[model samples]
Target: MTAKVLNIIKILQPVVIMVVVQISLAGVNILSKLASIDGMSSSILVAYRLLFAAASTVPLAFYMDRTIKPRPMLTWTVIGQAFLCGLLGGSLLLNMYMQSLVLTSVTFVAAMSNLLPVITFILAICFRLEKVLLTKAPGSMKIVGTILGIGGAMLMTFYKGIEIKLWSTNIQLYAHESTSTNKQDRVLGTLIALGSCLSFATWLIVQAKLSKIYPNPYSTTAMMNVMGSLQAILFALFADHDWQHWKLGWDIRLVTVSVSGMIGSGLMVALMAWCNRTKGPLFVSIFSPVCLVVVTLVGTLILGDKLYLGSVLGSIVIVLGLYAVVWAKSKEKESIQCIEEKEQGIV
Candidate 1:
């Protein structure tokens, strides 16, 4: 009985970890949105967030290096890859995402982010890392999922059918600032959010290659965060000339940077790496929609974000499509594993 309970706990461990990761991410989105409303520059926020992430992860990297046997030496090639990872994932992707958050609503940004798996799938095919076996059910489902995902995003972007009032707390975090955005700004924000998704997809491809070369998760993450901080600082300097924008005060902005850095970049990365190793990336990706749901509820009730009919419908469609792709990938992996097991038995 004791052993069975232990086995059940082990089985549920990944699920619990992923739930925490997603909730932490949801908090980041909420806090970042609040900070943006408090007049924080998105670029400056990115810089400080990455800086904090680097600071928090460096000790872990050193500890891991000391404890793990047969530590891999960091080659120049690995450094180059880390630079690319920092630029694509940390600096570029985050800046665009934060800027989009400022331009758009938190719910909108969260809903749109559900497109990452679809974007990654498309990118994988483009890079020839994934194949298109149209004759197979998995391949067909993937194609179908891609269409649904893109269609859902488009529906959400172009159509604001009706406003749905769920429940408002009547309490705005930043009530002084106007939440209304012009249609042009909304369109631009949507485009920028899409671009961030693409950047993240590209980063995943690069990170996968980097992992193959250097399997040390903590060290690799630390290096990427350090490089990303430098790049983001440079970009922020050019983007905002007001030296005051760089100042950190005892306010929500400071809290936003600290929490987002520690939770979003540091802890989330570690959890995701562990999950990927244990249950594969598909298992991790399946939880993406949870963040969206949590954000939508919190944004509506606490942040005073409006709920739109199109967003509701579009989110549902996107989640359905996301699951389709994840299911297809899971099936493909199972088939490959089964075949490998059979071959091993025969040998």
Candidate 2:
């Protein structure tokens, strides 16, 4: 293949991988809901997931990254990454999100997730990982996209308009009763979910830094998972002293831990780190809003969820906003590359 073809493939590969990551995340959301049905604490579930994730990734880290000698400060940097990503982002964020799912509709949980990219973009700018070139069209598009995405998410959260019934006879609308329909509970859940988004955004910033310092995806993931597992287990032990909550069997809980550990944390974290290294946190994070759409489809088709008008409308807006942001970033990158080439030619 020509260099141009290879370059195009390289640029597009992360986008495709990020989409797969979102789909896997959507599956994790549905499976987590299913697993939680048995009355498992979110903290406990997270603990097990982290443990499994650590076990699964450690071998790969040792095998793949063994040849590279680590800098002394790299350990400290990795620890920081662990605390930011594993404990706060992975364990705490997920636990809070799961709790929110318990209180609100799955659609609400998914919709709220669209706020991630907006949060990450803001954090990225604060950290100097992203630029706000207001003079440029790309910058304007990004700023506008951020506003639209956040606005759409807020609209979805507050508004539950008329239901939109689709024409598929097989897609029956099965309205599952929310655990707490009280307005207060929903509000609380929304707040918690928003908190999760903030933590996750913080993780993206930290991961971007780590990618530069460590530059080892598998080892970084394993270290983070190990630290997260320990932290989660300690929290779970303190919060839920009951031995029964810690019990594991050949059931959905097992499936949840296994799949979540292997695919969700192990695979997803590695992919995210690689993407962050190659594309930057904003590029990786912008794909998060897509999960809302994926989850809506999954909920409607597989889980027999009723499609609501507000959700559909808000999701459409969110998607449009996401596209705008991605387009802006793409154009900005291309423009920068072109300038570099021109400079090289002049030299």
Candidate 3:
């Protein structure tokens, strides 16, 4: 019975955990909308998210790592990496995402997230985190998929107003949306959104490397949330100057804070780390498209947003690109196995 249970758990773990991560993230979006109504500053909101996240995870990490002794360097490395992930990726990226959602429509926001895998692949190759072997189908497909993903993002962004002239991609959708946002705000939001993507993409690579070294994703995540929560709170206190209320009492504010922090930030990060460890960052990157799909459907059906053909086409391209990259990975693995087998036979 015990063996059967273990087998079932091992089989279901990835599916169950990925679903949890997706749900937690979706929940965060709802809470962010609610939190905005309370006039919570973005820093304060994210800080609260981190704080409750840390509080929940600390005990779990301690319990899991109680019997396992790790090298100081390893522990510190994971901690430092987690800090970077939280500070730049968690705090800054999230701040941009929240700010961008306010500036652009939800459609644009979701569209931008779909670029994550493409961005990660580019950054990984550029930074030499991932080797790009031109000879291999995997490398070629990764590059092609990256191009398709970026093209899809552009298509969604410009949509019906797409303007084409020689030597430039003159997108007309920007002009239309520019009407929705005044020049100054448009500039600010665009910068913020792009910055968010940069931070997020960089962090994905960082987490991938960190997962390789520190197998304990849970511990790494718990520590980062602890640090991030404190940093965000400090910023909130000075920037917004109203931490006293939530600090003073337990209310819905406190409840949301606790839930978003622990379950959303803490648990999600741990899941990401675990996914990165077991499946590789390549596999985790595919989740970007999954999130985009889920968010889009929800927004359209629930929020009554209009769907566009370009967006539809872009989503299909993204799905296809995801499959291409995954298939390429399998081919590469098979080739590697063949090489190893040949070497063993000769030896």
Candidate 4:
């Protein structure tokens, strides 16, 4: 029974990792909502999250590896690179994500999030980290999937302008209140999201190399958290943020920050690395839309937000596109395995 359970767990790792990612995101939203009530600035909130994650994780990493002296030289540089990636991706976009929640519809934000894979794909191509041979079905599917997903995201964003109905002026009919607000929010939010994609792509590129050099996920995560903690602190200080305005009266503050720090940053990062190893980066990313769907439900029902027709339709298109890409990859992988089996049989 024990052996059978262990085998089952081995098979279930990918599902488990995806669940971790989804729960982590849901936790982030819960925390964001709670933290906002405290009137905490986005930067400060990000700092606190990083601080808590770093504080908690450092000990775990040390305790796990007590037998071996921590190799500073081997992991520090990789950690620093991850830090820079997080600084660009996490620090910039986390603030943007916070700002977006105040201005945009959760559905719109989530739908647009589908663009991360496309953005990452493009960056991967540019960085020469990913290559697709047009003739290869899998590669073609990946490229097509990236395009479809991005196209769907764009449709979701731009479709509002296509209809100038009474609801268009209804302020809450769409995601953001006004065009100017939407534009400003999207301009910053999308940019931040794109930066997030870049950081993520950087992880795909850098971590692949790091894993080749050193395969310790715990150490890698802990050291990167340390650097992220430092960078977040510095950014907060340099931003001239005045903490006097902090009003922690709300009972939800601690709960939210606790969820965000522990689940979002802490557990998710560790699971992400594990998932990437087991499921391939693209495979791990395919399920992100699932989280968006959850967020949309919470946003519309609990938050009392209106869902526009175009936003709904566009989201569907984006999901279809995302699935199409994944399907293509799956088909391609099966074909490769078949040929490998044939070769083994011939031998």
Ranking by TM-score: 1, 2, 4, 3
Pick by TM-score: 2 or 3, better one: 2
Best candidate according to lDDT: 1
- Weakest 10 consecutive residues, lDDT, candidate 2? 171-180
The better-scoring model by lDDT among 1 and 3 is 1
Q: Model 1 off-target regions past 4 Å?
A: 1-6, 176-180, 345-347
- Estimate every model's Cα lDDT from 0 to 1: 0.86, 0.80, 0.67, 0.65
Top candidate when judged by TM-score against the true structure:
1
Cα RMSD of predicted structure 1: 2.0
Cα error, residue 265 of model 1, in Å, equals 1.5
Query: 1-347 in candidate 3: lDDT tens per residue?
Result: 69999999997888777776765676666556445545556667777777778888899888877777763355677778888877765766776777776665455566666566677667777878677687877989987877787776656555534322223233221122211235455456556666787787787777777767776777778777777777777776777765464452455456667777777787788888888778776666666655666666554544434456766776677667766766777788888899999989953
lDDT for 264 in candidate 3 is 77
Which candidate, 3 or 4, has the higher TM-score?
Answer: 4
lDDT of 1 at 235: 97
Error in Å for residue 189 of model 1:
1.2
TM-score versus the correct structure, for each prediction? 0.94, 0.87, 0.79, 0.81
Alpha-carbon RMSD, each predicted model = 2.0, 3.0, 7.1, 4.8
Which digits, one per residue and each the tens of the lDDT, describe model 4 over residues 24-127? 68658745754554456777777777777777767877786667655545657665666664565356556666666545645566676666566666777887
Please give the ranking of all candidate structures by lDDT, highest first, separated by commas.
1, 2, 3, 4
Model 4 score (lDDT): 0.65
Q: Can you tell me which runs of candidate 3 are displaced by over 4 Å?
A: 1-12, 69-76, 160-191, 241-256, 304-306
